[model samples]
Target: MSNERLRIALARSGHTAASLAQQVGTDPKTIERWVNKGRVPRLRNAHAVARVLGVEVRHLWPTLNGRSEVSGPVGSDLVAVYRQRSDVPIETWKTMFDQATESVDIMVYAALFLHEQISDWNGLLRSRARAGVRIRILIGDPACDAVRTRGEEEAFGHGIESRCRLAHMHYRPLLGVDGVDIALQATTLYNSVYRADGEMYVNTHIYGMNAYGNPLFHLHRMTDNGLFDAHAASVDAVWCTARPLTGEIPDGSD
Candidate 1:
């Protein structure tokens, strides 16, 4: 009955009103009415709607004790995970991400600069750093230049540059003499989507899991486990001596 809920569900599935109607075996006009005229579908129709959209029946009927409406804690395994060909849902992912404790380390071959929401994630990472959660990023050197010139001594242009500047100012340490918590690293061929929060780790495949082209993969779970641990240690070592991105380099010779 919630119009917004129905609309969001449809958007998530990339459904057109007409396509949705055909999928549910309803008339397109009826779906149009439900979406625009604020008409709620009947129970039988709702089931059809949910079924065709690959959504839970409870999502359409909130009062039906629908377990799908519940929001679990961040570290919780979801009741179901729906995979579609699009970027991960930011809002939902954030709720899960916010629950991370201890640390997050990202090793990526390439990263498109960031989404608008990423600043919040960056901030969250900073908070995690303060709380003793280690945060480390291993980003491709090529990707780094997209934001900042590799060896040039000036700040990148525009407002985003300021955000980049601030990131380094409050940046938490993953290593060095005073460092203990977070570590981040990068490799040119690394490409898997890896996230670890608390004891749970989820790896989403941008490339198929079986593909060996990605440098980011772990060979054996045990071997990779040790490697990741060692990688984290190395990150801590680098962060210790690395100048804060916000501050000018001491030599001023670069």
Candidate 2:
């Protein structure tokens, strides 16, 4: 029986037998056997192949579920840590955006830097969405109490709310696009989440400090219950309560 899942994943990731085998350090014939005969690779090779294919090991071989073990300590999910979000290189962010295959989820109060600092933020998102990636964006409601308090805490006065409005304006064009959903969240955000598939950047919120100045954790999902799962759950919770963005935010409002 042919391994349809492996074949589809290879197609979506633009990898053929020769290319995948070369990256996985195996012969092209072995890769062919895995697809043509449904032969599962060894555990180590399975993980290596999944990593290169930007997917979970179990996703390609369902029978291997619960058997894949993480080699490091409990904090193995942590890939890197930055003293501040600004410390992370721009190229790293771009690479993350480009490599995502399944989904891109972001929840922030007012991540103006994504647009102002990141080159072609809007264009990247649109291109990703066109590639059938599910995109969920949750921006803070500018008129909500949470936004006002966050502004006061950060000593931005009403500047934070203004920034939120500007973010809304920048994202307005994506409202009607397929595979993209934007919403207004009123929750008092404790951490801002920026996720691409199984990897994420978590910006910890600190009182009286700007978000960009706070510590940021880069995590990749490894175990079923890990730091990555915790942050991913928070994103889903907020997304459930967030109201869908319907129209534009008028000027001089709130």
Candidate 3:
């Protein structure tokens, strides 16, 4: 009944039919049809186009639910979007354990969420690692240039670095545990990423801004090559560049 969603999305992204078509790898006329007639693309292409346009598919087609409205050539999976990192449910964050089969990976500047949100996480990881789940966590090095720059930009002074140090304390319990790897990096983290098998939660970072306010994406593995892979690769790249936080980590409590 309404087509303003598609109209608004195009306007917000500043994407024209030609530009969007080029990014989505579709015909310009196809985009024209979407804009002029409010036609929706197939599930696979819808996700492709949404990623290109930097939006949730539902933002373009507001009337539909991703589960019902989309069905990929391979499978129907969602890439849920949130306006803020906190918008995602706690259960969704915890559900990573349920979904993870082979590994669990996280890359963040300071994982205050892990410290403040979850309870008894050390015991939880002990159980998971004992069960053969390989866990790797990467946090920012407090003394690194990237942290210093970010601290100044956020106007938090040394607060960001302090948080990173606090995060190391929270993770101290897992320091020597088998199958758990913790590292620190000086990389310029443009996005905070967390991955559990095929699903990934990513939050984009804005200049001089905290990560919480940035738009977050919970991308499910709907295709062989999609946003999930891109994010996973990013985590791997950072991991390779990072220095392992080896040896005994001092156990500091809250």
The alpha-carbon lDDT assigned to residue 58 of candidate 3 equals: 63
Clashes of 3: 0
In order, the Cα lDDT scores of the candidates are 0.44, 0.85, 0.74
In the order shown, the candidates' Cα RMSDs to the true structure are: 14.2, 7.0, 12.7
**Strongest candidate by TM-score:** 2
Count steric clashes of candidate 2.
Answer: 0
lDDT, model 1 = 0.44
> How much is the lDDT of residue 100 in candidate 2?
79
Model 2 ranges with Cα > 4 A deviation = 1-74, 250-254
The global Cα lDDT (0 to 1) of model 3 is 0.74
lDDT of 3 by residue, 1-254 (tens): 43455665566467887888888788999887877887877777788776665555664564454345345543233446678887876665765654365788899988788657777767767777888889999988887888889889888888888898888878877888999999988898888988776657888887877888788977666566566777788989999999888544323232
Task: Let me know the TM-score candidate 2 reaches against the reference structure.
Answer: 0.72
RMSD (Cα, Å) of model 1: 14.2
**Better-scoring candidate (TM-score), 1 or 3:** 3
- lDDT per residue as tens, model 1, 1-254: 33555675676567999899988888988987776665767788888887666554544444443334333332122223334313233444444345456556554322323334555555666566667765555432222433333223222233323443443333333233232332222222222344444222223333332212222221111223353344444444545533332123112123
| Regions more than 4 Å wrong, model 1 | 1-87, 113-115, 143-190, 198-254
Shift in Å, residue 99, candidate 1: 1.1
